[model samples]
Target chain A: MKRILATLLACVLLLSCMSFAAAEDKKTLTVWIPQYQFSKAEDAISDQDFWDGVFDPFEVENNCEVKVEIVGWGIYGDTFFTSLVNEDGPDLVYVTDNYDLVKRDLLLGLDPYLTQEQKDNVILWNTAPENANGEKVIVPMDDGVAIGYVNKALLKEAGLDELPVEWDAFIEACKTIQEKTGKRAFLQNWGATSGTSALMLAFWPYYFQAGGKMLNDQGEIDINNEAGLKTVEFLKSLLDAGIFTEDIVTESESVDKFAAGEVAYIVADLNKGNSAFTPAGIDWEYVFSLKGPAGYGARTATDSFAVNKKTVARGNDELAVKALMYITSGAVMDEFHSKIFYLPPFTKDASFVKDEALYALTSAHSEDVYVVEEFSAKKSFEDTLLANIQEMFQGNLEPQEVLTETMDYYNTQLKEN
Target chain B: MQKTFFSRRRRQALIGGAYILPSFVLMFIFNVSPIFLSIFYSFTKYDMTAAPVWVGLDNYIKLSQNKYLGNVLTNTVQYVLITVPIQTILSLLIAAFIAGSLKNRYGSFLRSVIFIPVIASLIASAAVWDTMYKPDGGLINQFINLFGAPSVNFLGKKPTALPSVAAVSIWKSTGYYMVIYYAGIMNVSTEVQEAAIVDGASPIQRFWYITLPILKPITYMIVTLGIIGSFQVFDLVYKMTGGGPGRATLTVAYMIYSYAFQDKRMGYACALAVGLLVVILLIHLIQTLFFKERDAK
Candidate 1:
């Protein structure tokens, strides 16, 4: 009886060890994405549910577990960097630009793993800087072009038949809307804090329209020219005329007011137009961009997926690239952009948008939209520029002083870097 | 016998050290090490991605030449002046009033009610205050509209932004210091108060002569904590104004955050942090000396 019991115990131990080894063999690919609004995912219970459903098929096909952690945009950059420095970062991440990662040698080059079919399957923005060996480190995901959103109902109430396409006309339209309706005609959030490149939406398009150049022939940031001064002066004129109130410095969300039909016009990105107006069923239309001396120029933004170099060290680089490609694949991007109403930059020959006006506005401006290239001093430059512009609106600084001080600061940062 | 007793004491000391080892290790790693590391990094140009390069006095020189530094320092000092005295005086008065006059269930209830804001998180408090400070149809604007007043943007204007943020700090912290003062007041001897009263001292006179003197040490401690806390103000400014409407609400702590996190200029931020520490230490030293001189007199 004792011998039989010993044999049974040994058999049980062997089975338990086998199960433990099998569990250890399984690998988890971690991914971090910011919480983006899914305006049309009413059937999806939560963000996790939507993401898990999207990744479920990929996970099944690879027979590997995909760990997706949805992070808040406020702390996403800090979290990623902190984890990266600790050498325990996620295998894949959604980042707007990966220049810092590439410069630090913390990004895996996807050139080797990308098949020719995969390369031809989607459009590549190549916004992120090439690696030391001139390899692509980012896969483009979505593109956001700066555009003006106007409340059609409010415009109609103010007796405007068509939206303005020029700087002076836009100002006149704002005045007429505010004078007739007694509602806020225009407001933009200038108080977007750290981690947000808010000036791109609120100030860059206007600056570009005014014939400003972000970089000169010397390839240095040179926005201290006549156009830069004019842009600030014009914005200050709006504030002076009561078209834009002094409250814009703290107006962190113009979309909420726009969606509620309290504001007639706001300069924002493409995604915001659908995210706010469609869900609320507000009557709104998009203006590609207002025209100034430089003609139409809208700032375009492309956020992409990047594989961490640590994935290579862990021997999971191929799998990480595969997952990145799969997520950015044309069919998947079409489905994803349909839910969030974002402009999918990678996907081609797929149309999920049914709204004629939205489709026309985005497609018509695709060829002319410009993207501000990545620079070492971009964040500091934007931050100081926003403050100087705010100071101009507050009447503390002249438009000339605003441009001088901001440009000087930007130049100093460039020199130091 | 003396040698045996010394050995016994040494054994006891070893046992005590063993008991505290885990906590000491953690504290050293998290707190003590970072402070020394910051001091070292203050002299280097580190962005956390690449290894730190020695920059000597470069960061400090740039900080001195920085046009915004003067304004940021002035704003921090302004915040400290606005919050410290107001919160200290308000807390002391409320504590004295409750402990002296309304020393009953109602007093306890009031104490609890006053401390509610203290327990609330700073982020939540700032969010609620932001809503109240909004110009269009916000609670404060709606209230003032009934009296035929125009809407005032509290956070949008440079003149009102720092003061508005400071007001939130005062509201949230007055109760905390009030609790401390109340405890200190409760510890005051009844005999001393009785003696003063019997000696023809009025209520105010007794409080002035007896309770106030007894609470002097607590006052000094509270003032020190208040100065340190107000000087390092970040969360309120971060949540409320973002050091904006053009550097009107820029504090040193917020500047450090902007440099370290937003700009990724970690070494520059560390230098700024070290400068702030020296200023704080000097202020603490002055306060300590002043209190000591007064006590000696």
Candidate 2:
């Protein structure tokens, strides 16, 4: 009888071991990203090291293993959406822009996963709203805004001690720089209809300067008044002055020229300035939107992340939320920003602004930093306006004509939608 | 005897069917199915994340209204019209020259060298071309500058970007077409060439009268291939200019990619793609009909 009991006990132990192994295997979570953070030893050490350090600690603390799958950036957008639709998606993904989450129902909402206290801790500006189905799909990983970068040396050469503080002064400064340095003064990415998007970044500051709002609370097109026309005229005058690069609509061509010091000032996303200028060892300074006649500084555009509601409903909510919080947390962001020289979205104290150039710009423009509303009613209208602006830059349409055409387009879109 | 004869015929038919089964199955699964699916999707709106919604002819209607589509279509036609004829003529000339003059071994070596790009991966060749087309540091610009020409933003300017991309496509495919023509030249009977030489016909005159007319079939083949290839041109444009300098290099395929992948307008993209396919098919049909008539005459 004792021998029989011993055999039964051994069988029970073997069965339990098999079940435990299966359970462990079932707990595996998959994360997808564009590229492996570290492919080269040096790149691994300098850039990807922080991701490993952050995730490794989190894994140990959470008692879960995380698997990462690297996809090429070129194909990631299509592949990620396709995988999500199939319900064979990853637990976490890195998205380049917030529109990816807002436009597609690919992410999970984190509301149910996080405690009220935890939700409250997140920056309000970074929180993405749910769709009609009520899913808070994405968490903003970084704050990206378009800003102007001025070459300090060029400004000094042009006998300017301080950067331009007003619209008129800005234009004069550009002219002075052009005359003195024989270099293109203002350069922007402009080419096709999409080039209009970059121009809108610069256009926003002028709109604010002219006391014109782009959209009202209801998200109607509001740039139909005198303020809007003034903004258009200002853009035209700049173009006429030959201050902007000839290839204003092209991507990165003008920015590249600026980086090579062929242009004195460039309008680009803050992230681009950080990446191109800082790494290339070009001495540059960020300029806040110059105060126009109305003395208002326009806010730059904001892109964020969202969670997919479908993923949340599948009981992966907690893990996904935790991953979102971890990536967006001040510490992880600070590491990413410092390494890549990107501007962090988190509130900056004296300690946060360690880089002198970054500190000076952020501190000075702290109150002026405006966030573009992520959800706009007239999104399509905004796209049309952008295209018209490109036409203006191309000299195919006069600025006034383009603005009028844009107003008509916006009116039509508003009526249709 | 009747039973034996019937059984033998049936067995022969079965053997022939068995020989083609693998190829037929593979083609159906890989090629035919995808084509049909694409056609079906073209009539629907598929955003990749949700079920496709049927929109019928709406996508085609929208395509007609799209101004950018018109521009890209024009660009594509220009590319086909210019690159096809020049590439065919250049390849034929080089093939004829090599076939007439060069030693057999040297000719083969030279042909191989020229065809190296044909075998080289499109992405790799595009990367090399990207450097060569760079406005500031590209080899093309340097050569132009050496000739006392001003620097031109070949890929950055709208007027030049499409032509520039076309030039690269021509350069890469020229040798492949040349090899095809070379084969055609080789097949020309030696007796005919010897007779032409004995009649004291000049090389150019002999080539024009004898070689050119005889190579009509090869020319037709090249034209068909060029039309299909040029319309499907995506990878090189994607890698090099990304249809940029403000949609200057935008082709139908690239537009479909942007709509499907970037904008998530899969239905619209599919419609655009289907439209392109139809256009290509129509062109091919017209060309075939005309060429067949010409050959018949």
Every model: iRMSD: 2.0, 5.5
Clashing pairs in 1: none
Ten consecutive residues with minimal summed lDDT in candidate 2 chain A? A346-355
Indicate which candidate wins on DockQ.
1
CAPRI class assigned to model 2: acceptable
Q: lDDT of model 1 at residue A209? A: 85
Residue A357 in model 1: lDDT: 76
- Give a tens-digit lDDT track for model 2, residues B1-297: 999999999999999999999999999999889778888888887766568888888777766767566878987888888789888988998898889898489988988888988889998988798778766768988999999998787776777878888988888999999999999999988899899999999988888889988999999999999999999888988777656654557678877776666556667777788888899999999999999998789
Fnat per model, in the order shown: 0.56, 0.19
Candidate 2 DockQ vs. native: 0.26
Give candidate 1 misplaced runs (Cα > 4 Å).
A1-16, A38-42, A194-197, A272-275, A278-281, A349-351, A413-415
lDDT of candidate 1 over A1-417, digit per residue (tens): 999999999999999999888767767799988877555554644556667888999888887889998888766766776666667889988886454566677788777887766666556544545788887888775576778888999999999987787888888888999999999988878877542456877888888889888788876777789999888887888887788766778877788888888999888767776566867888988878888778888887667788888897888888888888777776666777766456744656455664667667667876657777666656767778888888877778999998899878776643446
- lDDT, each prediction: 0.82, 0.70
Best by lDDT: 1
TM-score of 2: 0.84
TM-score of each: 0.95, 0.84
